[model samples]
Target chain A: MFGKKRVAIVGAGVTLFRRNLKETGKELSYEAAKTALEVAGLELRDIKSVVMGSAPDAFDGVHMKGEYLADGAGAYHKPYTRVFVGGGTGVFTPLAGWWHVASGQFDTCLVVCEEKMSSCYPHPQYAFTTIFDPILERPIGMNLIWIFALEMNRYMHKHNIKKEDIALVSVKNKRNALDNPIAQLAANITVEDVLNSEIMAWPVQRLDVSPTSDGAAAVVLASEDVAKEVTDNPVWIDGVGWCIDSTHWTDRDLYYPDYVECAAKMAYKMAGIKNPPKEIDLAEPYDPFDYKELHHMEGLLLCKKGEAPKLTREGVTQRDGDLPTCPSGGLLGCGNPIAAAGLMKVCEIFWQLRGEAGKRQIPGDPRTGVAQAWGDLMQYGSVIVLRR
Target chain B: MRYYQSEAVETKDIKEGKIPTEKFRPKAKFAWSAGIAISRFLEELKNGKIIATTCSKCGRIMVPPRIYCEKCFKPADGWKYVKDTGVINTFSVSFLAADASRLKEPIVVAIINLDGASEGMGIVHRIEEYGDWREVKIGMKVKAVWKPPEERTGAITDIAYFKPIRE
Candidate 1:
């Protein structure tokens, strides 16, 4: 939709996704931002604007967290803004950065995403309490797992999908994570292990969910001219789309993500992609939970409704499969630091497109890929398409 | 780029106080006003009634009543009482507490779509009178089990929980 100045991602970097990192949230952002600048062959002085994406202020236990992390994000004296749409913030960060360059307002923009989930006391899950509707949903003392389980149950019932079929996603992602240096829960396990894992909520087990983590990711966005000077191969930002559904989650059917489809359609329209399943080479749909990956695949129109499991069973989503998905291990395998997880997907796409992913790189030299992130009571979806 | 790495910390080290940590607990508490829709809804709840707001334009009877219709972006036409009975839209048996601690007994929570409300419009609440978790199925008929009037309060908890309606 943005037919103005073309924007390209010239550089990307990410910190290790872990349970507890000694560095503060700002330090993490600085580390990722510094690395991104180095890779882009530019200094902090060259950046004209900065865009910050963080999941929640509660995760860092810092109010007005954007301002607090601004200096570390290389936003000193620069026009900076924070974009938040729960976990969707990561890809949304770059989308905001794209606008800075596409609008001809800035030649170079630094996009940073960070999440320090360990800072929440007792348990990080406690911070999620506020995300619920206080008078309606919160009064019943609801936890995050309850909602995921509820949705999973509905999806399974609608499709007649067994828990074992969904467990395959966890197995595949964890095994894939074994190749990722920054992965937290990368493992070699069978679907049996996932099915046998401790049940946090029925149909939703411990192994099925992504771990709460602390990490940061960053990328450098530049206009066509700046991108040409910075790198010989630039991952062009072809399209960006985001959508949000009603906060009244109970008022809508949970079987399908209509919002995700809406966002994907918007992105596809901008990218001029008529057939996502055929045209897109690879994908990284948000997978906070195992079933969610499959749910999102359907939402992104990568596969038909209720047919993702069959494709997954046929190994169509493997790293070596025809349409590789989540080759960077994804949030399930890589570790979910909320905003950073989504940006991590974007970073993976960058490396994969440039054939620099080393161990995790897919066999084929894929040219186009899509990364999406979802969050906020299953209300928001953010999508980005990148072309080499 | 190949040499890039991030620093990590061990949980044991932080637990042993090996790292300097600053503790700050926020005392910030919020008293949110329920406003016209929810205030009246809560009053109705105390009177053992489930109320919903209807938007004349879109004809959506929204639960947890709102002053304005979300779809039409117009003021809700009026309030209407919904049946205490509902069907289970979806449910879960949670073994974890709100604080991530293990619970001694699992609680069955469900989103129950009330009869008189618009399709898919429902309230989230606990389910009771079911011993086996497997028995709780979607589309099962349920009715609100309200607390006695003397113990009733103008809150969502006033209705207590919903139980399966006997055939």
Candidate 2:
């Protein structure tokens, strides 16, 4: 891994995370890409290539969706590539961009991610039906909420963790998101409010879920040679790794994200990170569901296995505490717009690394950070390590 | 053929047993962002016009324009709008519609890679007035049929379907 090239995310930008957008997906992409380009001090013309990622063609209600999003990402004349790993697409977007530069090929790459979940009629959750096997899974009438409920149940059963212990994550993250500019569900609420909320599929309360959103986030990546010339605070993408488990999601242990462990090992190995719990200063482990953040924490080796709920309960994961995670409020607080939400996690790390996150910045001088997004039939973990 | 139903129904009631079973069907709806190139391309289609996004990095003139060239790493430059006519790439006989309801007749589902589009790039739609599945074949010539202006809505079905042109 010595010859592994250095990939730096010089700039990042995001549109307002919301439920509905008047602007179609392309306009959102333009808005986000413009901001990222401005931060990177480059125009669409300067981008040598484009890497675009969105969850599924079904969510967008458009077929050949990657090609549909190409121009919006300023990919029309560039060597454009689209890689999607379900909800992992957001994190994977930059990973795709990272490879473009790390391979000693491209210089400037614009990585864009967008998801408009509002368009799916009745409810956005209906879109999840297509994620299942048309032949077998669909026959059971599986909805996405049930899988989350089962995972939460197993997590609760395994850790001897009470419902109240998990509520703290929603409370803390939402409170932390108050200062976030693009926060969607940022609010101040007690654990009682969470428990009192509507239970969609048992164990998984409606409040525990991230709001369906329409959002886009873009990041510009360049080689170290060119990045140094543009900005002094170039956050290096030290390592990136993604792993997906088998499709039989029902057969796997729902208590943890097993794929995340392998993905984290791959990334930690590349970044030369020995003790993630001590070495990595901050993290934004994907939290589309409250328990998932804790699930990814253990998988990322932030603490010993099954210790995340305890860490979460004791306020260790808070912005002001040891190992501040999801200081940008996270998808649970800010919003979950599929791919955009994941990149938002990546952007927060960049801000923390540069001391430019303003009110959302972590307490200490955070030199090392990791962002992980897991999705795709609930079996993928896309991990990234960035260091200042 | 006509005498079997009444006797079979009476005999089935007299047979040993029948097991209770179940079947499931879900109505799937998805909202998608058309993005820039394709949205514009779709809008132009409603106006009886065709648009293609060409990657300057790679000279692929793509119908249903792409934001990125998937092949080259760069922003697309050339914008070419043309008449609506393309050759059939692949097709099938749809025995049932989206609702899983039976149709009076089977419709022809087709994938058409418009003449100017890149390799294997095109739109999926029904081949209008093809009579039946037996009539249409791969590589059949077809052209767009515009709906009346009053009936226009911004969707794929705006142009009823492509039909065989009188060449």
Q: Which candidate is the best by DockQ?
A: 1
- TM-score of each prediction: 0.99, 0.70
Q: What is the interface RMSD of candidate 1, in Å?
A: 1.4
- Per-residue lDDT, model 2, residue B28, is 70
Candidate 1's C-alpha runs over 4 A off are B1-3
Using TM-score as the measure, which candidate wins? 1
RMSD of each: 1.1, 21.2
In the range A1-388, model 1's lDDT, one tens digit per residue, is 4757899999998999999988888999999999888889899999999999998888777889999999989999999999899978888889889889999999999999999998787888888888998887788999988989999999999999988999989888988888888999999999989988998988789999999898999999999999999899899999889999999999999999999999999889999999999999999999999999999999999999999999899999999998888888889898999998999999999989998988888987899999999998989988999999
DockQ of 1: 0.72
iRMSD for every model: 1.4, 26.8
lDDT of each: 0.91, 0.78
Q: Write model 2 residue lDDT over A280-347, tens digit each, in one string.
A: 99999999988888889999989987888889888899988899989999998988989999999999
Real A-B contacts recovered, model 2: 0.00
